[model samples]
Target: MLESYLQVAEVMFMQVRLKAFIIFCVYTCAKFLVKRKCEFKPFKMLCEFGWILTVLLILKITGITTGDFGTTSVFDGNVQISFNISIENFSIATLLNLILFIPFGFFSAGVLKKLRSKWIYGILIGLIFSLTVEFLQTFIGRFVELEDVLMNTMGAFIGYEIMVLVIKLKDRMKMGALKVE
Candidate 1:
């Protein structure tokens, strides 16, 4: 009981400090891939992030942060197996995991212009940023698996790439229609 409480406290500390940097790094990457000027709503990104974090916070407080929150894993000889999630849970939790990184990706691509296109740089920064968070979480009794870090980073990269593809396609279509006209 005492250990759990201590862990919670530590996780809370890491969450508060590391979340912002990770968002910033991801946003930088996202900008390179997304050129659509959301000039109309400058605060949209901030508001969106705020809402996500707030909702997640509520869920965390309510003890529903993640589907794999309370499961134990055992090493069976050469492999490790987890007993925390059901089939339904596996889907929801994995979906949640992917969704969790979307905002960070958006911020990196759409907001921070300095780190755009240079995906290697952006990903490295994000990875280091995430690693720090995971390290902090580890001491706090949170799941500090590298797989989560890899997934989050991959999600950010994929989201950024998708944005880039969208922008390029939009530009191409506009050009093609202009040529025909």
Candidate 2:
């Protein structure tokens, strides 16, 4: 079972990587063309691209792209919704769901300069994204679990906090270097 799970994960990872590569190529070409017409910071553009990739990866991982959505009715009997909050129910899937959204939060915090200081917005974004993904999963013949939503939100919050901490440390280091000079 573990081997099968790993195989599925590997396949999913490859699919997402291929899609990301294609997106990167197109984004690069677009950026090149747009750069000539407007002035935008490369860092901000990269951060925004990262967030887009993160969202695509999440969709792919959740079987949204690969599932039999065409045949599966949204109200099908197979569409399971679990509100299981028990820690004993934890599995590798739970961990992956949590890890998956970290990039979502990180890129969101990095790209939204005005919301950088507002940690609540990062959490809200995470929550909304997770909620949307779970809702869509019902149509894709995947289980929609409340636990997954909660874990994803927590992961986003953690990612946001890490980005904030990094910025603060960078500012302090710059200040210290200036003082030393």
Candidate 3:
């Protein structure tokens, strides 16, 4: 038992292939460019993907999503993996995936603000980005789970709301005081 665990740990920490790292780099950078309208720094997304990819690499190294990557399942013989979290394994990776995409929605709202003021637009933006990621993952041999899409979009919506509320609060505070005589 201990030997199996040790083997998994050793496998998981091995240097991630340059090809995989580059793939993540290109993908994350492309998303950064798409959200460029707001003129905000892309620094946040750098950190976001840095952490996200790190988690993914770690999972891959450890073989957590082993035995065939897809949205399928069977109790015996066949093994399956879900991109989303399960009731039993409420782990850090699940939280990180949800947390990492918040900036995508928040800054995306900044981009959308130039066109229109709509929270639904933010939601749409989140869903689109997440769907793109999820679908891309399917090609990359990761499970594409709808449950992950829902949680990721929900996170985006929350991020968008926070940004909107902050702007509103700032406006209100400014309007309430310090009039020029």
Candidate 4:
């Protein structure tokens, strides 16, 4: 079972990487061409690249990319939307959902200037993204769960906190270095 999951993940990673590469190339070219007067910021570009990769990976892993919209009828009954807010639903899948959004939150917090100091914005962004995914899943014949949204939001919050911690640690290290001088 684990091997199957790994294989699927490998395939998904390849596909997302290809797509992200093309998108990034176009984005980079456009930025260079369109904003000739603006100075390039490598750090900002890196953050944007990370955000793109993270979103592409998330979309691929969520089965949103694999769905055949034209062939599968929405009423065919394969579509499952669970609004169950039960503790019993907390399982490996829930953990995976949480883990999946951590990178999203981290990148979002890094890329969006407003999200750096304000954690609420991060959580809200996570919630909105999760809700959008879940809603889109219904049309794609994937199972949509409310628990996933909750877990994903929590994961985003954790990721944001982790980024904040890292920033603080780096600042402390800089301070220490100055003191040693």
Which candidate leads in TM-score?
A: 4
Model 4: weakest 10-residue lDDT segment is 66-75
lDDT of 4: 0.81
Model 2 lDDT tens row, 1-181: 6578668767777667767767866876787898766556676677777877787778887877666665455645677889879899888878877888898898888877766768798789889989998888888777788999999999998888877777778789989999999
Arranged by lDDT, best first:
4, 2, 3, 1
The lDDT of each candidate is: 0.52, 0.80, 0.59, 0.81
lDDT of 4 at 12: 80
TM-score of 4: 0.82
How are the candidates ranked when ordered by TM-score, highest leading?
Answer: 4, 2, 3, 1
Lowest-sum lDDT 10-residue window in model 1 = 70-79
- Least accurate stretch of 10 residues (summed lDDT) in model 3? 72-81
Q: Give one digit per residue, the lDDT tens place, for model 4 in 94-145.
A: 8878888998888788778788877788799899999988877887767788
What are the runs in model 1 whose C-alpha is more than 4 Å off? 1-95, 169-181
Q: Per-candidate TM vs. native? A: 0.46, 0.78, 0.51, 0.82
Could you tally the backbone clashes for each prediction? Answer: 10, 0, 2, 0
Each candidate: RMSD: 11.1, 3.1, 8.6, 2.9
